[model samples]
Target: MTEAEYIKEAKKGSSAAQKWLFDELSGRMLMVCRRYVRNEQDAEELMLDGFCKFYSSLSGLQYQGSAALFSWVKRIMINECLMFLRKKHTFVIVSEHVAETLALQEDILDNLSAAEIFNLVIQLPAGYRTVFNLYVIEGMNHGEIAALLGISEGTSKSQLSKAKSLLQKMLLQQNIEYGKRKTQQ
Candidate 1:
């Protein structure tokens, strides 16, 4: 079915369309939630909350395009992840300041699968991982991340830095050492 048709049915509260949308998007949205949340059950719960909000607000939402719908749902999922973190008092952790810069190997990530990269991200502390996902992956600026996390912009920056450092350390620990291949002369 076309996106417009699906949207029309969903706006009218058709359970079938809603269920179809849920089945289609739930896995990807759950992965998005997992970026900020550590536990699988919590991530699933967060994704469900996002779907609940998405359906409840569908009537009022303007569907621009298929991509827009996905982005809208993703934003909802990210918000749900933040809510879960806030409820657990996880976001309140003081941001760490790591003076050392990270030298992450470029090709190492090239070799790792998306799941591998995601695993590395999930290993970060809650605050760092949230800030990292929001700033780096979600493409939100520090100001936006600060607003979402109720923190100063500096804190968001610090958290991203720490997250990167931690991720780099993790990569090295996993034997993914930093090295840029030198071109042969």
Candidate 2:
């Protein structure tokens, strides 16, 4: 069935349509959850929470277009995932000096694939990871990230800049090691 028909059935509370919708969207949504969360179990839980919210809100869905529906649902999923991460990870700002120094660093994310970037991001400390995800991935400005994380804007900017520098260094090191191994072989 087309997406419109499926949405109609889903909004009407058809279990089969809901099951189909969950099965169809779970894989893609899981990838989004995984970007913010490190553990597979936690990602799975976040994905379920997103789907539950999506299904609960289905009655309010008016299909402007297929893309719009997907985008709307994706935002809901991202918010749910962020909320889940917030519960698991706490953010603590260090000092004004540290935050200032962090902002002076340059970003180094130009050449990395999505998976590689996400892997490096997940390795960051909780504060840095959350700031990076909100600022870089979610496309929020530093002020927005600060408000969401309950820190100063300077701290958000600092954390994001630090996250970028660390990611760049890690990627560079990985490249150098890979090149060395290739030469040795």
Candidate 3:
């Protein structure tokens, strides 16, 4: 059945259709949750919660296309992760004066796989990770992020700047380590 069919049936309380949708989207949604949350178990739990919310709200969703469906589900998953982070009081925003932005070498990024980049992002602290994900990955502006996270725009910008600086340093260190290993071999 097409996605539209599944969504229509799922909305009508079809358990089989719901199961199919869950199986189709769970992996991607889980990864979305993982971007904001570092803990494996917590990410999984948030993903499940996101799915439950999505299923419950299926009645009101207008199924535009597969892309729209995925985007809506992804947004739900991101919200769940953000709420979890907020409840933990994990956003440690530093002052704007101390914010340092570093230029990341495009060449270095070009050499790394998506998974490698994701791993590097996952290593960032909670505040940096949340702001970075919101601005970079989710394509949200500083103002939107600030409003969503209940922080000032300056704080949002600072977090993103710090995230980038830290990522650049980590990338450089990884390159240096790789060069050393290659020389030894």
Candidate 4:
């Protein structure tokens, strides 16, 4: 069935249409959740909750297209991740943007796999990771991030700078670790 058709059925409470959405979008949504939530189990739980919200709101939700739908779902998953993070973590304000924005060598990035980069990001503190993901990956401006996270734009910039600093540290550690593993092998 077409996506519009599926939405119509899902609005009418058709289980099959709902299942199709779950089966199709869960993997992508799970990855979105996982990027913020460090653990797989929690990410999966968030993805499920996000799906539930989307399913229930289908009747009133406007569809701009598949890309828009994905965007909507992703925002839902991000919110769930943030909710989990807020509960699990004590929000710390790192006033100084001590994490210097370093332009790492392209050669280094070329050597590291995407999974390695993701793992390094996962290693960052919750605040740093969220701001980094929002600013860098999600392409959100500091102003948008401030509004979203309820902080000043300066705080958003500081968090992002700190995140960049931490990511660099993590990347360096990963490089060292990889070198050691390679020697061992």
Candidate 5:
């Protein structure tokens, strides 16, 4: 079925449609949730919350096209995750120069697996991690991130930079640790 048909059926409150929609979208939405939430359980909860909000808004959705509908819903999910993070008082404020330095370190990330990257993210200080996820992963502009977290744009940029630096440092440390293990073996 076409995406429009699926969305239409879901809007009409069909359980099967809902199930299909959830199944289809949950993976990408969960990644959004995970970006803002540190804990697996909390991420799951936020993912459900995003889906619920998406379903509730479905009736009101004016789809210009399939892409537009999906994009709108994805934005809703991202906003939900951010709001959930906000409720927990997890927003971080940092500087723009720091974000740039971190951005330059992106090349270091190419060697890491997704699991390694996630572990590195978790190791970041709260502020850096939040901004990094918002700016780098979610593609939110500094102004939007600052507005969402109630911080200045400079802070958002800096936090992302710091997050990148920290992630690079952590990965480097991990590489060294692996090298030591191999030498010892």
Candidate 6:
């Protein structure tokens, strides 16, 4: 069935359509949750929560296209992750001065694979990881991120800067370690 048909049936409480939709989108949605949350079980739970919200609100959603459906679901998943983070009070806002002191080498990211980069991003402290995911991956501006996270725009920027710097350092360290291993082999 087409996505529109599936959405329409799912909205009308068709269990088969709902299952199909869940099967189709769950993996991508779980990955989105995992990006914001470090814990595997937590990410899976948040993804399920996001799907529950999406299904409950399906009647209100205007069926656009597959892209719109994907985007809407992704937004739901992101919001769920953000809410979880907020409840944990995990956003550790460092002073802008301290974040500014770290210099990011842009070229370091170019050498890493997408999976490698994602692993590095998840390793960041909660504040830095959240801002980095919002600004870089989600293409949100600092102001939008600040409003969503209830932080200042400067703080959002600082967190992103610090996240980048830390990623660069991690990438460099990985490269150095790889070189050492290569030489010893």
TM-score, per-candidate, Cα-based: 0.87, 0.86, 0.96, 0.85, 0.84, 0.94
* Candidate 3: regions farther than 4 A off: 106-111
Q: Which ten-residue region of model 3 has the weakest summed lDDT?
A: 101-110
Q: Put down candidate 1 lDDT per residue, 1-185, tens digits, no spaces.
A: 97778889999989998988888889899899888898999899889889999999999888798789999999999888888788888874454454345645557666888899899999888988898888777889999998988999988877777777788788767763333323322
Candidate 6: which stretches are off by over 4 Å? 101-111
Backbone clash tally for model 4?
Answer: 0
Ranking by lDDT: 3, 6, 1, 4, 2, 5
Encode model 6's per-residue lDDT on 1-185: one tens digit a residue.
79999999999999999999999999989889999999999999999999999999999999999999999999999999999999999999987887764667656667778788789999999999999999988999999999999999989988998898888788778889999999999
Tell me which of candidates 3 and 4 scores higher on lDDT: 3
User: How many angstroms is residue 12 displaced in model 5 relative to the true structure, after the best TM-score fit?
Assistant: 1.4
The 10-residue segment with the lowest total lDDT in model 5? 95-104
RMSD of 3: 1.1
Give the Cα lDDT of each candidate.
0.83, 0.77, 0.92, 0.81, 0.76, 0.92
lDDT of 3 by residue, 109-142 (tens): 5678878978999999999999999998789999
Model 4 global lDDT (CA atoms, 0 to 1): 0.81
Question: Which sections of candidate 5 miss by over 4 Å?
Answer: 62-70, 94-103
The Cα error of candidate 4 at residue 76, in Å, is 1.0
- Model 6, position 17, has a per-residue lDDT of 98
Order of models, best TM-score first: 3, 6, 1, 2, 4, 5
Q: Which of candidates 2 and 5 reaches a greater lDDT?
A: 2
Q: lDDT of model 1 at residue 56?
A: 93
Clashing pairs in 2: none
Tell me the spans in candidate 2 whose CA falls farther than 4 Å from its real position.
Answer: 100-110
Let me know the TM-score candidate 4 reaches against the reference structure.
0.85
| Residue-by-residue lDDT tens digits, candidate 4, 102-179 | 654546645767677677778777788898889877989999988887778888888888777666777777679989
